[model samples]
Target: MRVRPMLLKAGGVFVLLVLASCTLSGCWDRIEVNDLATITAVGIDQYSDNLIELSLQIYTPPQGSSISMQGGGSKGSSSQNQSTVISATGINFADAVSKVQEKVPRLLFWGQNEVFVFSHSAAKQDIAGHMDYILRVPQIRGSALVFVSRTKAKDVLALTPQLRSSSADVLEEVSNLKIGLAMSAGNFNIMLSSSKGTAIMPSIEIMPAPEGQPQKRYPAITGCAVFKDSKLAGYIDDNITRGVMWFRNEIDMATATIVTEDQGGIISARLNRGRTRLKPRISNGIWEMTVGIDTREILVQNTSNTDVAELKGTRIVEEGLKQEIEKRMNRTLQIVQKKFEADVFGFAEAFHRKYPKIWNKEKGNWEEIFPHVQVKYDIKTVIVNPGKRTVPTNRMEGEKG
Candidate 1:
């Protein structure tokens, strides 16, 4: 009888332990997705001397339906509006965010934000200061793409995109294409924090509406903002930005069109591959840098009489490609290295890697020496494919006629 009583007490204790496990596993503080306002994009602009304005593009679902919080939806749909923009002003980014939260009825959630745009004025004022607030917010993504807007960042956010769900969606896709300089907030911060203290950000501008389509204006990556000492030094236009990309070894796709002076016609070549190397040398206490470019291009369109099958004709096209690349790079160097005097090309880092001791002594005066650094280009371009036709179609057609 005593043994039977002990067994019954142990069984009751086992049941009690199972009940406690269920209670511990319950999600008591879980936030419902329906109650959170998902932020898809954010913009920061200077409101006044001490005030900063924050704009958020929030994703709003259809009125009656509750969708999963996975941020999946058709973009640029003609049927329903998917998002809304809200703005608030405060002393700093954090304070402005708090003000924005007050205006929003639902809790502002930044987990889905994909793009961050800063107005040119705001960038020039103090981007590094603003960047601190951005990184400190644990909810925001460090991988979010960043851009500089020529006008108010909020205006860029407000533009109605015809092909995308929102302006942020449009920006995210374009920046990924790498046609212009694409930088994530994390990499941007690293660049600013580097010893060289130089960085570059893609610049966006509102393009004119297409003919008879006044409501279809959209933002475009038209140039780049060059920063020196954590401040906006100047900008490089689209053409010059391509050269910058080449020097940075970031060029993935490009088209080179050159006028064949001897043939009196035009030839356009598509770059299949491009590589750049920076060789820094110190001879007799003189710093000289050589930019070596190795590229393979395919002839896409040729109105010239140059024959791709013939060795002599191929050399002509190759020579033209080399000169064209040199021209673009020289123009870029003229503006960025000489005019802006901004070391956006990582020359300081390159020198440091090659000559550490000398760099330690010379880095303090790098800004003064950067403009005077001698640069030479050793470019070699080869025509990998001349397309299906060995000779110009136009020339062949004329010859037959």
Candidate 2:
């Protein structure tokens, strides 16, 4: 009996000791926040003599006194100066990053990075090389938004805007608004790796500040950069970009303005919701594609004297809206198909799904066949609402229809 009791006490003491040892062990990979340079954005450019330039936007915390004073105690000062831009050059992307690391006092950390930008020259020459480095990095997030700058990408990072602390914040907020196609690093990689190996990324440019304003310039996401075979092919304006969006079934929101000749005025409608469908068919060995668009819009502004609440008035306005949409779609198709000869739209995927046997045989020559593929459009538009008033308040007596 005495031996049994002693054994039980020894076992209990061993269990306690194991638990205490677990709690006493310290984390081996722990890093203090104060010793890190948290990167918010990255920019890449091509330099002469086969070199690469890397730029980083690192967040810098305010002084201790400034922090305490602005910590809910004061409203006059703002935290707009929280980031700084630094640059370095090397033979390749990784080498350039290493050189940048040598210059930075603290360890460069990319876990907080939100934006990646490439200059036009860099994008045209070796965007794929840049992307490879970004994908292989363990600390970098795959969801970081990507852009191509018309000017030197480093210039974009150096901008100072009154609304946001850094250019990265402004670009990220705008991307979320769905005004244009929002693509991340992962999304670009997938698109480039697909069967077609074609992709598009939002393009940014510097817009001069308003005349007589204190600020020199601001950055704007204006258009798209189209890629063919993982290389930059060309760029398109906002109007053409929207047309591409329509074919991809990616339009989140848009506004259209139509002028009514019969009513002698202009009307504006806001797109509420929209959906697109692509039907692929082969007739007598000829590839034909029919695009169907179903969209709903609300009349937000009626400058004409026509009462859109009436059925006849609504029908007239609806027809005009349909024609306007058709025109945009046709123009976009002509440009992407006939002019650019690139299938940024995933028409190849649709064909692959419907006719796998034929797709496999011709997948290699899709580049040649895509430009000749006959396309047709069928669009339907409905006027869901006519706003608060049926007619314009500023309508003249003679303008009434």
Candidate 3:
């Protein structure tokens, strides 16, 4: 009996020891929230003497009573005091980033970065060289939104807007709306590695804030920056950018206005849904592409006397919309092919998909042949809804016919 009691006590002590050891083990790589300085945006610019300038928009934690119980304060107020911009210059991107890190008090964190902007000048140089560090850094996300600024990229990061907390917030919001082609770092990398090595990224420009606004400037998606051979080739305006978007089948939402001679006014329609099909054909040693667009739209505004509710009038309006779309497509195609001579539309890929053997033979001289590649447009538009009033409110009541 004595031996049995002693054995039970020894077993209990061993169990207690094991439990204590397990409880004592804690997180080994724990990092305190206060020790990190989160970066919301990054900007790259070209400096003199072949140097690179790196700018970071670091999020600043609220102090004292500035922070609210619900977390961040009002959107406008929070962003006004929420972030600070710091810059450093070096011979390369990584070097500049390292130098900037030295000045920051806390550990610089990029996991939450929302926007990355490159200046027009910086884009003209070797973008691939500067982009290598961004791709190699495991801490940075591959889906971070990217842009090219018409002015200094740092200026874009510094802009304060009335609607959003920060410029980064504005850029991200606009990109989500699909106002322009949204390109992420990961997708851009794929484009760079593709056979054509052509890419298009949204371009932003600073504009004056809305009247009576406190902020001096705001950022807007103005156009697109075209890249060839992984370097900035040129820029296309907003209209041309929309055309490119149509060719790439990326048009999610847009508005088009057409003037009707018979109606004696303009008719505006909002694109509800759209799709594009590219057909590549080789005939008689000539390569040609046909772009087919099928779209459904809603008649939003009608200044003309045409009764869009009637089948005959609706057909006329539909025909007018188709002609307008075709005109825009042809204008865009002409500029991109004759002027830029760049294949941002992925025509090469279309050809490769249908005629791989021919593509391989012409791949070397795609640049020379792309300009000559004939393009055709087939657009079909249908108006799904006419607004509450078929005719404009401004129209005279006597002109009901």
Candidate 4:
């Protein structure tokens, strides 16, 4: 009974301290929504004079319309000023973003931000350096998506998307679709932190607007940004990008078009799944890696053959596509290994995993040895459907019966 009373008295003192702190207001890190500005999207481009072109997309309360009545009132196509876009040129990201606040009526904020883009020049010069602001900021969420732009980041964000309210939101949704690599701050950081291999971020390009269309245009995901030790070595086309995805086993819905053997036509195969197995062997001091890829595919569209109108013909198409896919994948792997001399596919990681002791000795000579690494690709494909109609969807007008 004496011990119980002493414990209760101690707990009472802790409660009093907690209440006192709450009454004294928040801690030193306190920041309110209205007092601080929100930044929706940020872009960085390299300027010639040791400067940077930084662009910011800030969310603003609807002008001439209340928040509750947004997109619901009887007005036709509501007002245009939902958010603000600003760009500044300075020596760094912080300097540029700070300049933007001078002109904008509303305070700049980044709480609802979604995307961060770096121009090709910025990425090539130094991507990690320019992204320092985003990495350090406590308010800026680490989940924001990242991209490399062909043009200035500001020009890309100025586009008026017909569907989404924010261009940043448009890209956020696209990244989840997995058409390309998942590129966010967290993902980029992880890849940078990886030991053996480097990370690849998707490249964004702006399409020319048609005559009478808007001056600015929405950015499109074009290809992959190849990075070697936090710096961009180069970029690859879509075909090479797809090939890289094959090695990583990230291909879920890729269409492969193959030329028919007997007839001069094209057969497009839709890949359902791609599974890859990499095995490394040391033969007489020469490292050999076998890259076996098995894939399941279906016939989506055929533009070449006509005489073969049976379901059995699908099997023949499958085999042809399998060979074509395999050949292309082999070519890509060979080029990257021998020509680019960069291991973008984690081949080094696989080698290090199995032979840790041997890898340690070989690590010093990896760059010289990587170009000579032998890679073998094996691809298998399967066709599932031939549309709802089993027969040919199109028929010749005057056929000789």
Candidate 5:
């Protein structure tokens, strides 16, 4: 009995030592930072009918004690030109990536990449196919911003940014401002998988250089690319993109400028906040959607002679603003809804939420029903502030003490 107890204790001690040793062993596949070629952005283009080209913008760290200060720095400043572009062509996204890896001496790392630019031709070919590899790859982040370039994406990546560290940095800043349509990789996938299978991505193009200043060029977001059935349908200009933002409830910062009828002067108002609601109803088997917009704006500039201090004058200005907004929205609807037949405004999702069983039975017919769906708008705008000046500068003489 004594021998048996001693033997059991020895076995338990051996097992405990083995478990402790396993815990002390760190990751077996750890990669060193020095061996990594960290990518900041990725650009995709169609090289040929069946070949795909992939470009990577990799970050280059500043060489020994050469950090450039913003106020004054040498032409060889580290902050100015820190990224380099490398490209390779392959049969598909994965194959292209492998080719790029073979060319690069260091191991390609993707954790820092936050921007993906697709050329118009590549996007038209089938963006969803590219997105499939992106979604499955564990290294690529889901929140990466996606953009469609008016020109070749590789060219866009090659252009150096004047303000930011790299082209990717500039694109990320633009997306953060919400100046136009900004779609994330995951959100785009969700949109494509939605009931109607429609999506939109911001469009970027190189800004035209001024005469005699060919070097002053940069990528700018000018519009949006519409996608239907996982293919590029068409594009919408900036003005129409704003209207789309209103319909999608994605408006963050907006300026509505209108020419007042009373004074024939322009007045610009900045949106303080805005909300949109979509109400779906079925009447006699007819699908109808009512869009309600409630917004508050502050007058930023009043070049009109109208006395906005008075109640009557304020109402008139508000009416003009309302009309301006409606005009843009109507134009957008005409092109996106009636012409392109794209349900990018989430109308299908709204209807499905409202009527689940009916949606399930009729989801397949959403594309047919979308273009003809009756849409009514209820827009209400409140002028929260008329700025520090109650009366316009031109109408100061007409003000009473």
Candidate 6:
């Protein structure tokens, strides 16, 4: 009887404790969706010497909308003007963000944020410090795309995306396609970590839309920002950017146009697979690096005399292609080494990896050494297809024209 009574009391106390814990846990970390001020993109512009302009695209929740949040497009905006974009000035990024929120009624939430565009004025300034702000911030997504806008950063964000709700999605897919060099906070992290203290970022320009189009258009990559020791060194053209891509072994979907003396027309080849190997050697106490690239090609466009039946002609075409590719790669190397004086190719990293002892002795003089580093290229290309033409379309001189 005594044991039964004690068991009953213990059971009642346990049940009460369990119910209380459940109630507490359920209520914890709960925030209403209505309270979140969703920021789609953050744009920074140089306002003055002492202050910077910040713009935020914020979504306004509808009061009586019945559409579900899971739907592809947001029904949160009640009308054309319901969604809002606002701007404010502050000396620092955090301050600017806080000021922008003062006018916004809801709490600023960046979990859905997708991009940060630095104005040309802002980017022209020492942006290592500015980029640092984004790196250290906890609320921002690292995957968010980073762009250097040719025009004001705010204008890029204001271009209304017709199909998508935000420009972020468009840029995200563009970066993935390797349309040019990938420039994002995540990629910046890798760039910042390079031992050579150089980084390259893709430059995006805004162009006028077609006559009938209301919105402005963002064109393909045309420029690259060069960085030396975390400061803006200068910018390079698209050709140099392609060279950089080749050296970095990150070339994707690049078509090379090669002209052969024997071939009547230009033969274009698209690289399917390519690998760049950096080999370092010490010759007579001097360090040298060789960049070997192995590429497999598929014939894309042939506008010349393509002889499919003539195996000898195909061989000649392949040799010509190999020479052309090698020439382009070597030319790119010269610009990077002799002109740019930028070790964007990781020659230093290659040396450090191969000859650590030599690197220790020569690390101090890398700047002076890079320009003189004996770098050579060996490119191997295999042409797998001849396109539609197998036999000679334009016959040899012996054959009838």
Give the runs in model 1 whose Cα sits over 4 Å from its true position: 1-29, 65-78, 397-401
Off by over 4 Å in 4: 1-32, 67-81, 99-108, 195-197, 303-312, 395-401
All models: lDDT? 0.88, 0.88, 0.88, 0.74, 0.88, 0.74
TM-score of decoy 6:
0.84
lDDT, candidate 4, at 297: 73
Put down candidate 6 lDDT per residue, 1-401, tens digits, no spaces. Answer: 69998999999999999998888865566668888888877888889997899998776655445554446556445324334678899997888988988988778898988777777777766566667777788978887877777778787767655445455555666778885888777777677666545777677676667567656354445667776776556677777787778788888777888676565678777888878888889889776877888888777776666553366766766777777766766777777777778888878888988888988988889889888888777777777776665544445557732
Q: How well does each candidate superpose onto the true structure, as a TM-score?
A: 0.92, 0.92, 0.92, 0.83, 0.90, 0.84
**Model 6 off-target regions past 4 Å?**
1-29, 59-84, 162-164, 308-311, 387-401
User: Number of backbone collisions per candidate, in order?
Assistant: 2, 0, 0, 8, 0, 4
Name the lDDT of candidate 3: 0.88
TM-score of 4: 0.83
RMSD of 4: 5.2
Q: Which ten residues in a row have the lowest lDDT in candidate 4?
A: 74-83
Candidate 4 clash pair list: 37-108, 37-109, 38-108, 38-109, 38-110, 39-109, 39-110, 265-304
Instruction: Give the runs in model 3 whose Cα sits over 4 Å from its true position.
Output: 1-27, 66-79, 212-214, 394-400
- How far out, in Å, is residue 25 in model 2? 5.9
